[model samples]
Target: MAQKSAVAARAPKKKASSWQKRDWVAAYIFIAPVTLGLLVFYIWPFFQNIWFSFNDVNKFNMSTFVGLENYIKLFSDKEVWKAFGNSLKYVVITVPAGLFLSIFIAALMNAKIRGKSIYRTLYFLPSVTMSAAVAMVWKWIYNEQMGILNTAIKAAGGSGHAWLTSPSTALYCIMLVGLWMTVGYNMIILLAGMQGISVTYYEAAALDGAGPIQQFFKITIPMLTPTIFFVLITSIISGFQVFDTIYMMIGKTNPAYDDTQTVVMLFYRQAFDYGYKGYAAAISLFIFIVIMIVTVIQLIGQKKWVNYD
Candidate 1:
């Protein structure tokens, strides 16, 4: 029996070849840079942010451990709530609007029309434009007295209002700019997803006497689920982290700043401007938790509808 077992074991069981091992090694080598980058840049910073959040760090040093003192201050602060509220409001108003418009534009762009490339390029312009430049241009356009938007309102026989300067409208104006710049980016991604879908489904739908609208709702939308999910997640992530546009457009010292600022913007102000590093870290940590919660909810919900091809 022992001899029989030894023969069975030695009957040249197929091992993974050296070439396969070499290929795996080569792939790991190629991925090493990105893996190392994540470890150093992302992972380390993440842990450090958490550590800083719990400590009474100052300008010169990570001086003392305060153990949730910063967090306590965050809860009792009215300004923190204002900034957080602004961020939540921005997310609520922007996400759905952006998602709908992006999908609509993407559908239009996918159509076989004359000058399609030109249209795509035109639509994508805002995405390529720098945020600083866009903010500067929009700042001029939102000028209370001389801006083109107010001038247009006056031309249309309507009252001229301070768009960005007004607390009532400043956040909305910021949202509008965000919508303009990003809608096309999401469109591009959706368009790519549309391209990946096989036309046979559409052809099949047509053969079944389905109209274009029916085909879109029943076939296109279902197949595009994964893409929509990706776009939605990314947009939410970006919207929550918004800062530069708010800073440049709203101005740090603007009267409307508190109403238009985000949590991240608040963090920046508290950390760099006020030299409250620990407080900023605490705010940052809260923002991180909120983002994580949103993302996890989306992931859980997506399991029901995200179609894989």
Candidate 2:
């Protein structure tokens, strides 16, 4: 009996049936299109861009191996540094302001207020609006002579300065528009996170004699950290890549163009306008590296504050 039991234990397991094999094939078939799409559109282009950065690519797509010449030029370009500074400033200013406004608006929307759904819809409309349209409207609103803002200032016995043309204010004006465009979307995201928190936590806080404000500070904020982290990362990335509004609102001939130009704008000018594709590729890689470092830092830092529980 012991010998028979030992032989049974040593026997080989049965192979998977034809039906199981068919199921595996079907799963791969379902996923193959998506995998191929990513490889063709995303993965291949990424490696191609990296290769372009190491060569001298002209407007005609002709490339010659340059051995980091493009990268060396990138480091020495004053305009590149200026554009990077502008982008860094944009991120530093917009991220905090946008976060505060988004949190405040989301908190208000989360309250038991009247017609909040309508209010939410109204606030969200700008987020869905075309970015070019938004930029054009703001450009009109900031017109030096005929803008409503100037008219209001003139009517109030105050002088109107050129808001979008002055180097001192142009970047800030763009930051304002960015904040307006993004706050609604961030609020919606934070609102969803706020709604996901359990009612039991609030009830428990109330039983402990905590007021609404206290409950908010104690429960809502902690529970909402994960969403806040997500918003911060996305906002920083968007702030760094600000291009459409700047392009549409500020022309190359504009006096404030240098003040408001971000790194992506510089890359656009080099790649398309100036026909230095290889140098532009290097700039693009720099932007990618900066974003990656920032994201990695955020990921590491989130361990201290982002409360998943």
Candidate 3:
């Protein structure tokens, strides 16, 4: 009996049946198109862009090997630094401001308020609107002469400065527009996260003599940290890549172009306008590196603050 049991234990497992093999084949077949599409469109282009960064690529799509030359130029380029500073400033200012506003609005929306649906729809309108259209509308609103803002200032017997043309205010104006366009969408996301928290927590807090504000800080905020971290990551990335609004609102000839130009705007100018594809590729790589670093740092930092439970 012991010998027979040993032989049974040593027996080879059965091979997968033909039906199982067919199922595996079918699964791969179903995924093949999407996989191929990613390889062709995203993965290939990413590696190609990296290769382009090391070469001197011209307007004619010709490339000549000039390893590290573009990267060296990138480091020494003043405009690149300026653009990077602007982008950094954008991220620094907008991410926190946007997060605060989003949280505040989300908290309000989460409350038992009348016309909540209507308020949400109204706030969300700008996020769904075309970015170019939003930029154009905001550009008009900040127009030096006949903008509603200026008109209101004039009515109040105060002079209106050129909002989008002034170096000091142009970036801030664009930031405001960005905040307006994004706040509603982010609020919606936060609201969903808020709603997912168990009612038992709030009830428990109430029984412990915790008021609304105390409960918010002690329980709600802690529980919502994961969602907040997600928002922070995405918002920082978006802020750093700000382009459409700056491009649409401030022209190449605009006085405040330098002040408002982000890394992406600089990349666009180099790649398309100036025909420095290689240098543009380098700029793009820099952007990718910066975003990657920021994301990695956030991922590490989240271990301390982001509450999964």
Candidate 4:
């Protein structure tokens, strides 16, 4: 009897029913590469960033640990505060205006028209085209004296004022370019959402003697709420991250730089140019907090406006 039991045990318990063993093997294979990569790259580097944020960050030697002194200095720094204010201004100017403008453009593009494909391609071209090239083109377009904008103003019997160089209009000019660059992307997204709505809803409204304007407010706006909500959230996040355009358009020595510098731009200058890694880390953390708070508030408010079904 003991010999029979030993033989039964050695038979492998029916081989885990096949499916169980296969599942285990498949899971391991699927996760192995991701697990290894995360350990070597993301997981390791994330800890190192945290460590570096607490240390003095010396160039070729061991870094000394500092407490909250870096954070304290950040709160008192005027330039840091200025950068924060500028970032807020940019978000205020861009987010709402951009969302509305995108929706309006999408509505216009959705209308029955000739060469609709060509019009769509033309609009979407900016969204897909290289940002570096776009910046270079806009730089010339916003040129203080010789730009197309100024020439147009002159031809229209108006004074050709400074565009990007003027402190008064520097940030606005950048914001306008950003708006133009992103409008097509937002329009395309909104248009897709609009198209997904059933034609029966519009037909019903028309049968009820509703006009185009009435149908838009009653049907189109309500149907497009989810898309608008999504666009708002994404646009706000991207607006906070408005750095590349500012860095490209406004040089370090430019007089308008002071007015247009953003939080990320300040973080870059502090971390690299001035070698204030800890302080930069503190500013970055604060910016993260600000973005989180703003996004949460917007999401909460969206509950009142955004349609789920």
TM-score, per-candidate, Cα-based:
0.90, 0.93, 0.94, 0.86
Clashing pairs in 1: none
What C-alpha lDDT, on a 0 to 100 scale, does residue 192 get in candidate 3? 93
Q: What's the residue-level lDDT of 153 in candidate 4? A: 89
Model 2 lDDT per residue over 1-309, tens place? 999999999999899999999999999999999999999999998999999999999889999999889999999999999999999999999999999999999999999999999999988999999999999999999999999999999999999989999999999999899999999999999999999999999999999999999999999999998999999999999989999999999999999999999999999999999999889999999999999999999998898555444
TM-score of 4: 0.86
| Residue 149 miss distance in model 4 (angstroms) | 1.9
- Any runs in candidate 2 off by more than 4 Å, and if so which? 1-16, 306-309
lDDT of 1 by residue, 1-309 (tens): 999999999998789899999999999999999999999999998898898888888888555898979999999999899888999899999999999998888898899888989999999999999999999999999998999998999999999897887898999999999999999899999999999999999998899999989988988888888899999999999999999888888876688877897899889988898888888989999998999999999998888555443
RMSD of each: 3.3, 3.0, 2.6, 6.0
**For residues 119-187, could you state the per-residue lDDT of candidate 3 as single tens digits?**
999999999999999999988899999899999999999999999999999999999999999998899
Where in model 4 is the C-alpha error above 4 Å? Answer: 1-47, 306-309
lDDT of 3 at 29: 100
Q: Show the colliding residue pairs in model 4.
A: none
Candidate number with greatest TM-score: 3
Q: Candidate 4: minimum summed lDDT over ten consecutive residues — where?
A: 53-62
Using TM-score as the measure, name the better of candidate 2 and candidate 4: 2
